[model samples]
Target chain A: MSAKTWLPLLALAALTGCRQDMHDPPRYRAQGSSDFFSDGRVNRPVVEGTVARGQLRADTKFYQGREGGEFVKTLPVELTKDLVKRGQERYNIYCSPCHGMVGDGEGMVVQRGFRHPPSFHLERMRELPVGHYYDVITNGFGAMSSYASRIPVKDRWAIVAYVRALQLSQNATMQDVPEAERGKLSQEGRQ
Target chain B: MSQIFHPSANTIAKVSIFGAIFFAGGLLVILNEVNRSPYVTRVGVAREQPVPFSHKHHVGGIGIDCRYCHTAVETSSAAGIPPTETCMSCHSQIWADSPMLEPVRASFRTDRSIEWTRVHDLPGFVYFDHSIHLKKGVGCVTCHGRVDQMPLMYQQNTLNMEWCLDCHRAPEKYVRPREEVFRMDYRPQESQQVIGARLVKEYKIRKLTDCSVCHR
Candidate 1:
C-alpha cells in the first residue's frame, strides 16, 4: 500500500496501543492484587499494636459495651428515635437474615437450614443486659460470625437499642403503651 | 502525443475520488461500532470467579439486602467485597458439606482472601465513588442493572466515558429516592421525568460534568 493508506492505519494502531497504558496505570485499586506481595493482595495487614488515626476507641463502655469487668446495664449512648431507626436499618442488613426482623430467629437464612437463634422475647434473652447483645454482635455468638468488621461501633449500639425495642414490642401489655397512643391501639384492635 | 493516458483514465480518476469519500466514512462508522461491541467493552460477559456465587439466589430468592454483604456501599469509594466470613455466616450451617462451597470453607479456615474476579472495572483515571452516586439517589439498578436477577455477576453497561456522560449531563433522567437506592426491582411510580426532577432538586444532585470532578 502507498504511504497515504499506511498513514491512517498507523494512526489507528497508535491510538489503540497507547490506550492500554492509561487504562491500567501503575497503581493499586481497591481489592486488586499485587505481584510484589506474597499473598497477591494489594492491601497490607495493619501492624500489631498500632491503630490508625481516629480509631483509638478508648471508650470501653461505648466500644466494648463494658465499663469494668461487668457488662453495662444500660446503653452508653443517648437513646433517640433516630438512633433506634438507624439501628433497625443496620440490624436488617447485618443481623435480620439469621436473627429475623423481629428477632424471633425465624429469618430467611434460618429457614434455609441455619441454626435457629433464641427468640428475643424469651425470659433469658429479656433478662440479659443491653450490653450482652452488643457483645454478641461485636464478637460472634454460637454459629454467628462477628459483625464487628461489617457493622461500625455506633451502629452496633444502634442494633442493640433496636433489639431492645423489638423485645418490648413482642412482650408489651396495654399498660406499656402510652396513655395518648393507647387509644390508637384499642381502636385498631376493635376494627 | 497520442493521449498520454487512456480515454478511460478520466472516468477512473472520477470514480476513485467519490470512492475515497465513502471508504473513509465507512471506516469511521465501522470503528465506532467495534469500539462499542462486547469484544471491546466486555459488557454482558459474565466473568468466571473462584466460586460461582449467585446474586439471584441470594438477593432474589432469599431476599437478602445488598448491604448485607457489600457493607461499605453507602460509606466508601469501593463497594466492599464481603470477606469469606460473610459467606460462612450462612454456608457454615446451610451448605456445610457441599463441594461447591469447599473453596469458601478453605478460605475461611486458611484466612486467605478469596480472589473474586473483578467486574465493572473502570479506567484508573476515572475516580468513581459508589457512596456519592448512592447518596445522590442513583439506584443500584440504574447502573448495575437488575443484579437480583443475574445468576452470575457481569458488567451491565459499557463503562465508557460517553456512557458516564449520559448520566452526568442530566442526572435527573435516572435519580430515584434515596431510600430506593439499594432496591433492585424499584420502578418509578410516576413518570421518570417527574420523579427524577423532584429527586434531583430534593437531593441537590448537580450536573457534575467537570473534568476534575471525576478525573481528580
Candidate 2:
C-alpha cells in the first residue's frame, strides 16, 4: 500500500528468489563419511550416531591418565600432547594478541589498548586447578567470549596443561633442575 | 424419640448421605484427571495439528537422533524445530503415499515450520545448554529416556530436581564416551566407574555433594 512497504516487499521477493536459486544447485554438503575415513584422509566431520571410527577416545580406558591401570587418575586424554601443542599454537594466534605469548597478561593487545588479564601465574590462578583454567579459557573469565565454539574440548585441556608448564618454568629454581643439566648450562655459559 | 415408626425417614436419610458420598467421589476423580499434565490437556483441547507428528515413531522405532531432525544442537543457541524440508528428506522416499504425510508436503510448499508441541520443557531461567551437556558426555537418555523405542514419544522422565541430582551426584553413572553420548538410551557400555572414581579423586572434585554443583 505504502511506497516504503512496496520497496521492502520487492527487495524481500528478490532475496527469496536468490535463495531459491542457491538451493537449485547442490552447492553444499553435510560432509558425511567419504574415502577420507579409511584412506587416511583428513578433516572428517563426525556426525552424530556415525560410530566414531578410529576415534582416539575409543578403547581409552576411563582414567585420569592415558592408560587403563590399577590406579585412577585424571584424563591423560588421547590428545593430551597433541592438543597441548595445538593449544600453544592457537594461543599464539587467537590469545597471544591479548593474553601475551606466555599468558602473563602482557599481550600486544593489552599494551596497545585492551585491558590486561591477570597472569595465569598470579595468586588468584596459581591456586586454580586445570578445570578452573579450562573454564576460564572456554567461557572467558572476564572481558572474554566463550571459546566454547572456537576451541574444541581436547585442545582446551591441552592449553590448560601448557599453562601449567609455563607456570612451572617461570617458578623453577636451581634445585628444581637436574644437577647434571645445571652443570652443563653453567659450564657452557662460562666457556 | 421413636414414638412413631421412623423407618421411612431413616431410609430417606441413608439415601441422602449415600448420594452425597457418591457425588464427592465423582468430583474427586474428575479433579484428578484435570490435574494431570494441564498443558497437554489444553493442547488436546485446542490447536488441532494436521498430522500427528509422533516423536515416538521417529525416535523410538527408526532410532533417529533428535539432532538429526532438530539440526541445531551444536551450532545454534536454539535447537530448531524440523522444517518441512528436513521432513521431506525422509518422507519424500519413505511415506510418499501416506495421506498422513500430505500435511508435510503441504507445509513444504507453504514454507511453514511444523508446530510440534514441546512436551518436556524447563523454565527459561534454568538455561539448559544442550551443547555443554553434550561436551560433558551427558547422554540424551539421561534426560529424555529410551526415546528410540517409543511408538509415540512421551515424556518419560520428570525433569525434577531430584531426578537431576541422582545423575549429577554420580556423573559416572550417566557419562559415556562422547560419541555415544547423544544416544537416547545408552547405558554405560562398560565399567567406567572405576576410572570415573579415579578421575573424581585425581581431579580433586570439590562439590559432588554440594547443591550448587547441579543447581547452578
Q: Please report the candidate that would top lDDT against the real structure.
A: 1
> How would you encode candidate 2's per-residue C-alpha lDDT over B1-216 as one tens digit per residue?
656766698898889999999999999998776655545333223223557776566655544556645555655545556556556544654557789888888777775445555555553334356676666666677766665664444566656566667766787655666667666656554578875565445544433556544346
Best by DockQ: 1
- Model 1 complex DockQ against the native: 0.79
Give lDDT per model, in order.
0.91, 0.60
Clashing pairs in 1: none
- DockQ, per-model, please? 0.79, 0.02
DockQ, candidate 2, comes to 0.02
lDDT of 1 by residue, B1-216 (tens): 587899999999999999999999999999999999998898999999999999999999998999988988999999989888888888988989999999999998988888998898889889999999999998899988999899999999998998999999999899999888888888899999999899889988889899999899
Q: What i-RMS does each candidate reach, in Å?
A: 0.9, 22.5
Q: Can you write out model 1's per-residue Cα lDDT over A1-191, one digit (the tens) per residue? A: 99999999999998888667778999988888889998788988788999889989899999999988789999999999999999999889888888898999999999999999999999999999998899999998888888898999999999999999999999889999889999999899999
Docking class of 1: medium
